[model samples]
Target: MKRLFKSFLVCIFLVSISINFNPPSLAEPTSPYIRYWLICGPFKDADLNTECIKNEANLSPVAGQKVDGKRWRRFLSCEDKLTFEKDEVFGPYGNSVAYAYCEIYTPTARKVKLYLGSEDGLKVWLNGKNIFTNNAVRSFCFDEDKIDVQLKSGWNRLLIKVSNITKEWCLSARFIRRGDADIKDLTYRPAMLYQLPVKKVEVSSVQPTEPKNKGMYDALNAIDKDRSTRWSSEFSDPQWIILDLGKPKSVKKILLNWEAYAKNYTIEFSNDKKNWTPVYSTDIGDGGQDVINFRRPARVRYIKVTGTKRGMRFGYSLWEVQAFSLEDK
Candidate 1:
């Protein structure tokens, strides 16, 4: 009877242990890859700690300029530490001008926080707008820039320009949840967003051909679909940028993403491309981002911005000159 009791006790103990033991997890672990689109360059005589690196305006494919050996490649990072030593990344490189590193990611939550570390100067753009920028070259430290970003539900673009003033040009990035927890239960995708009608207008011209910085203040940059690139005229009044919308398309709205130059301006339209008529004029233009909607759609081929008075000592400057029609769309 004692032997039987002991056997029963052992069986009971085994069953209890089986009931308490937890099984291995069948859930898929989160990925640790930081996918990025990277491009390096061979540049010279560029400012080290400045917004110059962030703007790829003077780089290749812009203003007929090219970065001798500029090549873009897709990269996925799987390491905890990021570095650009004499051995690893674009080393033996001098002051670079046109280096670009960007990534588009979608997160489970609408809001996220990012942690970044870099050896030198870095500029970050969220949704094509400047958010955080460190235009100073210094030693690398973890969590150098901690930023909280509101991500759009579907997709968001993050553009980073890391400048290599010295030999060591490195960058590291990571995302965390609201409570500073590790990123989990998130989805990763290579983002290809649907583009709107935001691009270079077919034809753009400035009255004063030679602006303040002709290299940067090109009429082409204003329509290059880049906010960093802008068109600026001389520090004088009566400056205008004529935009030929290819052919006549309904233009009811005009968004002037200005750079604090034109305070008073008028929007003129011309159908025959010779005689022009003023549709709307703003004397109280505050000069940041002004969106002007016409009383009705203006079906014209030419649209011009004529500056009546100079806001500052500088002339008219436009970052992005865009036109859209709600009815046409």
Candidate 2:
């Protein structure tokens, strides 16, 4: 009986050890991630900081080092940083809402190392532990080290310090999640909003013609004697050019150019010319020449071009206008 009791106790001990030895998987929760607005900074402007803190309710001061003459700081809470001048906001999942990935772009020639810091720009932290020290101007960049650890399924705050010693200060950051909602769905739909008719211009084709310029019609018929030097007729104004695409399709890019400078003009599209929606335009510049990249995902048959300020005549001069469908390979 003594031996049997001893064996039973040993078995119990072994079972207890086995239960404690293996740990549970950290990824048990499978709910979709939530989207959070990221905000940052007052730095030189205390008023901005106060407003951000009020709006976000997650403000925290980060400590940082001084590299060169400029002072730097890192904030864990999104409420303390400034919006990126360009490409500021992004998601982890390539514009989707699933995987969480964030990157920052900084303009500086020198190599930079980042760390998290505290108030008065003196403390630093990494992976929840303090590390490194320096005094330099902080610039923004895509630092893999700064984000590798803090990233999780839901909203995550990334704090980083940048050092710049090369050129003028310019910084930008972007964050995205993998499984987020498709931006294409939340796209701007003209039908939902009341909008005025916007003007645009389109050139069908431009070919080499006779030296005497009689506009687009003259150039199409003119023959080129010298193969090297071809007479090209350019169309200056269209008031607005309309194209019948025949069927609704996805447009990836649009290129517009005005031979001479034209005043206020806008680009619009529609299924029928009567009701139109503006897609691209220019305020004031050399002619109305521009390449517009739009994120609007929609189907339409007609594209209307219109002029806003009519006194100043502006028309598009095109060698050719081409529309392409986006493909995934």
- Candidates' C-alpha lDDT: 0.62, 0.34
Q: Where does candidate 2 have its weakest 10-residue lDDT segment?
A: 91-100
Clashes of 2: 46
Highest TM-score scorer: 1
**Model 2, global lDDT:** 0.34
Clash numbers, per candidate: 0, 46
**Positional deviation of 200 in candidate 2, in angstroms?**
16
The residue pairs that clash in candidate 1, if any, are none
Candidate 1 C-alpha lDDT tens digits along 1-329: 99999999999999999999864321123334343335455355665444443354322222113344444433333234345443324455657643545544464436778888877777777766777888877887777788998777655656666766776666777777779887655454322222125323432334355456456777887777788888877676677887876665556577888885676888888766688877777778777888776433445677878888878886778898887642211
Q: Which regions of candidate 2 fall more than 4 Å away from where they truly are? A: 1-238, 309-316
Candidate 2 lDDT tens digits, 1-329: 99999999999999999988854221122111111212232122222112222322222322232322322232111222322221222211111110111222223222223323221122223323434333433444322223222232332333333222333222222222233221121111011111112233333344344668434342222122222232122344334445555655445455544443435667676776677766666566455345655443334566655544432332333332334333110
Candidate 2 has a TM-score of 0.30
Where in model 1 is the C-alpha error above 4 Å?
1-35, 48-69, 86-88, 97-100, 107-109, 185-329
> What TM-score goes with each of the models?
0.41, 0.30
